[model samples]
Target: MIHDLLLEREQRRTISKLGLDLMITPEGNIKVVEINGVNSGSSGVRELTGRDIDLEMITDLAQNGLPLFHLGKLKDQVFPHFVSELSHQQLLAQKWMHPRAPQKTARFVLPIVPESSDILEGIIWNADSDYYVFNERKYLLINPFAVEHAAGDKSRVHALFQGDLLAPLRPKMAFVVRANKECDVSDFKPNTTYLVLKPTDEMIGRNVIVVPTEDVFCPDGSLKEHPLAAYRRREEGWYQEPNVIMEELISSKKIGSSRTGKEHNGCMRYLILVESDKGEITIKHYGGYWRLAPSSIQDSNLQRQLVANYSNGAIPEHISDDDLAEVRKCVDTFVPVLYRRMLRLPINDRPDDLPLEAYCY
Candidate 1:
């Protein structure tokens, strides 16, 4: 479903690569919890599985070419731009020293240097010359705006799930409301035991509040303090109501880790690559990895076991052959539906005025 949407946009001037964080229920149902665009992790998968997906990606790019980096002609020149509020020195150090740094394995691409980077609307400019500098080597920046729309916000995903195409694949959402507004706790589904409150665009499991529905409200007909604390810390004032999605909490199936000999609340990260060539589009499953929650399922803290995210201290686990086969079967079932839906939908969002050329440096 997401691949088709991304492909339509890629046919225009936009391109996207996806990393889906999925929760596999105890019943073997696959539910998508999050979709990451260009900022998704490939290095971590390499570190865990010893599979160089980055190399595969670059190889594919060279042959087919993505929207911005045409014909893989500039594959060697393109650099992954990391956007954050960190200081220039700090960012540079991370790019070079981080254990999972892409430059360590994907040597074709150079690390980014702050001195040569010039921030623009969607593209980065090299202040000194046409080439960007890192370790005294020159490279080009991938246009950030080219993949911006591919980064689906939670609200967008929620809205998409409202349609029949993706409804079955998404968890049951209770309601989507602005954080500052007074939400009626009674509106939640009667039988729903647990609910997840998540900010629309926050990543790495930040600002996500998961609690039992029964504890959502105080006895005196008021909202509980714990759930509201994340929202209150915003400096944008109380009236700045960002969209918050309240969905039924999907319990992660327990997977036993061979290394630890313990069962853990786990999630799966499946990477999907969508590439557009001369008017043709292709989609491929670039393999996947499993993430075990920081604590085991036996942990006393329910919240700690619920969020299985790498940034939140979760670690990667090897996916056994049996587990991989099961997931592949599920994904195979889902892909055809996605392709059928893509064929039915008209490409309406592509900008006709823009040239169908790569955004080269």
Candidate 2:
């Protein structure tokens, strides 16, 4: 009831794959006071984000072929400015035996390397609380959404919100929308929260419009039309997480799902992204909890060959068509991009790694 269960599962799967926080159950049933989210408004929610370590230094190390451990260790220092503040109070309350406040993990947007024709379309709506970044100057685009004020009467809205009250809401995403803008929303229903991998540049205080889910997905396959439609589809078979289906899709030239018309069904809608290296191109597919990189072999033939190898085969007899369609989305999108910034800077480049920290406004 609180969030999109499918997207939530994908979200949990995503963060776990990236070595982030574990998912908690009853997320919807959880006390409003304890659930983490942003307040809705005409303007939108806005939060600051940055990293502690230097990107140039990290890039330099990478170029020099230095030990990867340093990079990993440096990763610990990277935290979202907004999340750090939220985490601080949560931890303090935990230490003092006080009621714990909801804490949001690091999230953000990264810049698309302009002019680089290689954009991964499957990852346009990626968002994760904890983000990982490997760039010196990176940012994330965020979308704004509303949650019923369940977190205890805004007792300390100031303490929790960290950003200016009249400030806009900004959640990291692959794209950004300005205030008063109307964007396409996915077939996703209203009040239904879906998780995405954080895309990299926030429009900085701007809320992006998303297309409606109904207009987004075809009619028959839409989850709203038939609740069972979105369930995992088994006929598509088990391709495992991060597998790609385009080779089969393009080859078969089929527009429908992986369901054999039996019990198994598949994703109701698909994620459509426009990427540009020399120019922008369109990519469409279901996405979540998976990073499907069609091995970037130099040879185009090899790339096609690699994709074929990764395509899903026939769904298992026991697998429900619904199940296959849902999980199969994992391989459809690009990995979520992370934008990390250190809040408390240290004089020495290396600050003893710190568990994500935060400060109240």
Candidate 3:
């Protein structure tokens, strides 16, 4: 149901790989929250080893420098940023690969310079540049052109509410707002309830705030400063970003959930879509987990952690079997359609590139 949002080239530079985030309501509705890239999922090997497991990628890049390309000053910014991140990772890998031990106990001794190897050769949309460098170089990104114009945007997803197929699964209402203009919570149904506010471009639950309609404004009747203003101000000075999302806060229904019988506020379902050699698409059920809201909204110490973004490490350990299955079914049906739309877009620069066809099931 997503549509395109016009953006300038500089604004589009950060577009990377796709990791769609979805919320499962108590009534069994599947609603898309947002999309992301370079989120907090580590590979199985990295998890087991407790380290970045792709030393071969670093060795190859340093030994045989691959062609680096970017739009405008991106190359200047991206190249150095990646080199520093990779260099730090490489040093750690080198340390672990060699240890002061008996010859028999020593792991395979890696040389000062790593041997070159071939990695995946393809472009990754909405990718994290630094993370990509240590992961693998074979999948050399074609840069700039591969980024889908507005792939992971909340604005684009909000516009999709009009589509018939998504209407049932979507939220009752949502809209965009800027920092300068305060939100009119009275427009939403049950004006007495809370509303979900999120910064459009931010990820990892950085600036997501769930506040009651009345609490949003100050005692003096002026709009309160953003929840993230202090932190963001320290980082980039006093400038309110003009784009934020305001949506009807869907109160998650209590379920006979968890082995402990304690109720959770809500849950998140993560789904992934991959393309095969013949341009076939496959939707994989990645992971589903529960998320809890703040216990006391009035307590300033309590923060409403609405987004269950993996990067923020907001995973709930317990979920009932039925809840998991229902979410899975919804994801299996919904993701293929999303992938099909993605395939229709021009996602590659190579002539041999093929569009994603039917779902592989």
> Per-candidate RMSD vs. true structure?
11.8, 21.6, 13.9
- Cα RMSD (Å) between model 3 and the true structure? 13.9
Candidate with top TM-score is 1
Per-residue lDDT of 165 in model 1: 45
What is the C-alpha lDDT profile of model 1 across 1-361, one tens digit per residue? 5445545433432223567788778887778787666556655477686776655654554442222222112224433432223334563564421222243353233344575453212312211111122221122222122232324366544444434546678776644566455565565453457778887777777767677776665555356654555556645454455567777888778888766788998888877665433345455678778888877888888777777777777778877777667766666665443332222222322232422121110
- Whose lDDT is higher: candidate 1's or candidate 3's? 1
Least lDDT summed over 10 consecutive residues: which range in candidate 2? 243-252
Tell me the tens digit of each residue's lDDT in model 2 across 295-327: 222324322222211123212112235433532
TM-score of every model?
A: 0.62, 0.17, 0.53
Candidate 1: where are CA atoms >4 Å away? 1-15, 65-147, 163-165, 182-190, 217-242, 276-281, 332-361
Model 3: per-residue Cα lDDT over 1-361, one tens digit each? 1223111111221212345555666666667665443332323223333433123222333333443322112222333313332343453464311222343553222233334644443332213332222222233442222223334456654444344665556555445465445455344443336666676666557766666655554554444654334234435543656466666666565533333355445545343433322334444344434544433222244343343443454434445687668767766666545544433333322222322221111
Backbone clashes for every candidate come to 0, 75, 9
**Prediction 3 global C-alpha lDDT:** 0.42
How many angstroms is residue 340 displaced in model 3 relative to the true structure, after the best TM-score fit?
2.6
Better of 2 and 3 by TM-score: 3
